[model samples]
Target: MAATPHPAHRFLTMKAAGVTLAALVIILFAGLRFVHLEADFPPGVSGSGDLYTDEGAYSSAAVRWVTTGQWRLEGDFNPAVNLPVYPLIQAVTFKALGLSLGHARLTSVILYLLLMAAVWALARRWAGPVTALIALLVMAVNFNAFAFSRLALLEVPMTLFVVLGLLAAARGGATGTVLAAAAFLLALLTKTAAGFALPVILLVLLWRPEPLTRRLAQAGLFCALTGLGLLAYYFVLVRGHLPDYQTYFMTNVLLRTQGGLWDLGRALVRIIWYGRQFDPVLYPLALLGAAGVLVVGGKLRRHPLFWISVVWIAAYLATLATQNYAPARFYLVLAAPVGLLLGLMIEHLARSGRRGAAGLLAGVVILALAVSGGRAVDYLRHPQYSWASMMRELHGLVRQDGRENPVILGHFANSLSLGTGLLSLNDHYTWKSSLPARLERYRPDYYVTLGGIEAPIRSVLERYGTVEPVRTWDVFHNYYTGEPVALYRLTRKSPLEASRP
Candidate 1:
């Protein structure tokens, strides 16, 4: 049996609890960040030295922007690959903190912190203080958020803007509407994929308590203006850049969404499994809450917060399934909604006076925090910093070959280019059939292959030079693989012999 407290005292206690939860979130994320600051990669790649692929491209772009005062891709002005918001943020960080991987990643860390703060605000708005606290706790320790926050990538920032817009929409006023419009525009500038959120936002506005016709008209005007502004901005920026606006829009948007049906199915499965992986107890509870609204659409169905989460999950899933590729970080958009749903579900259960069920939920939360926190601690402090040595050796080998600014080609060309200060080309994507011709055209001095070379690619290289080991690599520290990395220099062959292949 529990004792009921005086109303005044209970209010004070709740306020104290909220403050404590806020502090805990700050300490947890900030501490986790610094604890794993040297997690696996070296300083130049990511602050925590993780082998996140996009970090290299984004950071390299930032370095170029900061030093040369031009936003370029692969040493040329190309706006096709990424939007300007993230690179612009990184460039500002470079100016203030000096150009280093740690400083570049610091920008992401800060954005993630802001993201957590936004989650707390949105959760508090939908649910009470207790759910808000739990939501913050879950986000603070969840491995994906912890890990991705330390990398210089755009996912966290994109999610941040999206959540901010959602929060503004939830507030429901003239000011909130204007803020939502601005936030959504910023979200699009961060990542064009954010356009997927438009459907969700439209759904939200329709569900608003205001009269249907007025709300729809207002939402329509606002969205139209926002889209026009974004187009005008992009039009101004694409001037004199390679892969201009039309080409970028067609390839990244139109072409990218055409296939990958299998990928969509797989992503749906992975999102469910990984959602559980993040928090076994809470995610299932979230699903239960979702089902509750579907089955018992009383007030919950009409609630603005409920519909917001519903739309977010549906829109993001559809977007993920339709996209050509799905990375783990792309699933991050689901985290906040899951948190809110969990809180709502738990609140619903508690209100039904199922004390036993509520007790079990508490147990699950405790178990999840302890289990997830323990795993994160082990991964962070582990002494698998050997990847730094491997990259250093590879950099040395490139320098030893007496080829400054040499054209180098590999699968992870962006990471290698960033690490080695040499021209690196990625063969992972795009016209594989033309790889040989491109190699001849680029005329790379060194070819790097992870694990070993395949026959087709090897045959092309063998036409020009024989394979020789640069150095034997024992392990790759990032993915924790023991595969040996091989580097080969394409010694010149006679023009006739080279043409024989």
Candidate 2:
């Protein structure tokens, strides 16, 4: 009964709707991450185990930088290790926000929000409005990704840099190349594991439909800049600490290489187990999407997004399987790729005039929201174990003098030092031949025996002195996943100088 609307009017209406929908998606994603943002944060030094005082170590440096105005990695309450960019960010945040674990975690929560937008923007370019929204929703609904965003950890920042770098590199210009190169360099600086995805950035450049010389030029420039940045970082941070760096390599890298062909099988099983992070619905859909891409991706097969996803999944999964393994938080980087792959399938379905595409997408979103909602509720009810209060209490127990805060010596001693502002040292990674001497040299007023691990420390404590923990607390990597870590306090050390070799 009404005249047909003008074509421009229809286009305007659709554009407005798309923008509004995107706004809602981003708002929802950010809101979820911010809720209970400080849940069990600063999880205390070694709160997550394996010297997992990751949050403490980083926060301590930032606090020192801001309070003492010295970037002292060797001074009291300092760990011998260092990471520059992330701690610097923390210092800035603490400088402004008055320095609490909550303020520090704010950085990750913000980065988490930016990461969602970046994923959506990247997908919008690769697929379209519908596929972009689909990808963002899928990523947002991931509970592991959601859960980890509440920590003051480097992984979220590294992953954000990776996605942003790829997005910039895909834009196809000299400016984009430079921005992408910088972002990639920042990722590497955040953690060396980021090197696993370096080749993907180069692929983005070389795969461009441009003259070979131009592509080569851009790729060469990107490599040169990134390499220079890494060198400068090393020159500044590691050149003075060569021995410590070597120890880090031996423990972090060589120890990881201890297995053989049999490990590949174990790695497969481990990765499958880790895939539970994607949950009952999203992961299976991703597998289906991955298979679907090969059969029906059409133009997507030639797209950089497809190749990037393939390369990242292969490289990260391979490395995760082989060496440098840790908790499933390592899988956070894959969230975007997995979502994009699923979006690819949805895009193909929609293009084929399948109206169920809308229904299918809605189903995925609703299911993801429902599942993530359950996780959120569970998280709030029973928070993760925090060792912060316990560490402070133990330090207080044996401190006979207030003029000097008692030193804490054990695994992740840096964290104890940082979190509690007490002198702390642990030769946790030093060659075993020198361990006894290393243990005797510190003469810590107190010693902490970690769970089932740190036999060397326990042996030294036994051989030398009266070791006791006033009390023990139950803790895990996250919400009780692994064995409980034991906390011991060395209440008395009898003539450690006599026990030394």
Candidate 3:
């Protein structure tokens, strides 16, 4: 018979197991994100075409900055649409890697890796190594988190800074407080959605057991430093466009307060549905963890990290539910805490000697990985979802028609611009009212429409020029459903062209 292990030896063995688990989580994250990055695309397709439309805009702006030395969108210096820090980082990536979609997306992947590391540190500090490992696993396999890691969006990086801020604030000292403030500032500048972290940060600072006067002073100092940083950012980057910035802020804020009771409830349901889609098993696990946190309030009430997690989730939900619209990516802020909460729940199960329950929890982690990882693989393999071939065809047509770096207008403008190596004037989803005025101002040689145009916009295009049918591409949503989006090239009349001149 094998000798029974010493108590100290058992503890060391457990420690080794925990460390191995953490390393496996990191490996899973890296593999799921990096593997098949180049899969499911047409041969020689431009990397920029892999991005979602808004993602294309961000990448395009970075590409423009690389070529034109302006960080904003070419011809539009508005900071309202594109923040500086993300674009600057993307520009640096393009500078180093020569401007491919893969290169730009690598920046997001790197940010996500750092984000995972920061989340691990925070979870390890608040909970323990096992909880930290669980937290990392939950986040690594979440579909929404996994999806964002592959795009060059602001949410992942913003969440990174917010987690760093929370981790720093948990340390409770003058230096920690200062670092927390700096991280918070970076989060805000990265994306305004991070403002939700502010109330939670202040609350954590207040809960510190220092003298009331000292606590107030520290909290005030943190807020002051954050405000000063914002002021500096505003003066340097957004001063000339301050009104635009205010409008953007007010529009988003007003949206939060616009809807009625039913709307709010519907929004709440949608958030739950989104969470389910992202991680069906872990979403419920996090909810159970949250309930566990409340049930064991006596032990947790004095813990600042506990309050921070609760407040963080509450603030994000409150803000998100109030919004007129919330995309799934907006919930990236909630993922880290949800992951932490799930970790806490699993730890609770272990402490209570529920080995079977803990084993079930481990099974749920594998389910999350299988569902989300499979989806990621499918998404990467099907280039039809991205329309890369369509963009390539459009670029070919533009070259064959003898247009020399001509400007293209309309909704598919970014892809057309990137694919053809030409200038494109597009505003993603908006700018409908300004379409005619934009056409009059820019006099783009080609106006392309993809995914069909509204009757009114079609009328305007017909009035301005000739509508010639271009190739139609079938975009597949899943194995069962597919739809054809016809591309049309609208050539401006010489008379209309002269009118602009």
**Top candidate by lDDT:** 3
Itemize residue pairs with steric clashes in candidate 3.
none
Clashing residue pairs found in predicted model 2: none
On lDDT, who's better, 1 or 2?
Answer: 2
What's the C-alpha lDDT at position 417 in model 2?
49
Sorted on lDDT, best first, the list reads 3, 2, 1
In terms of TM-score, which candidate is strongest? 3
Q: What stretches of model 3 exceed 4 Å from their correct place? A: 1-15, 18-22, 38-51, 73-82, 171-174, 242-257, 260-266, 296-302, 352-357, 370-386, 415-421, 427-430, 476-485, 496-501
> RMSD for each model, in Å, please?
5.0, 4.7, 4.5
Query: What clash pairs does model 1 have?
Result: 41-49
**Model 2, span 161-223: residue lDDT tens:** 888888878876799889888999888767767887788888888888899999899999888
What TM-score does candidate 3 reach?
0.85
The lDDT of model 3 is 0.67
TM for every model, in the order presented, reads: 0.81, 0.81, 0.85
For each candidate, the alpha-carbon lDDT, in order, equals 0.65, 0.66, 0.67
Ranking by TM-score: 3, 2, 1
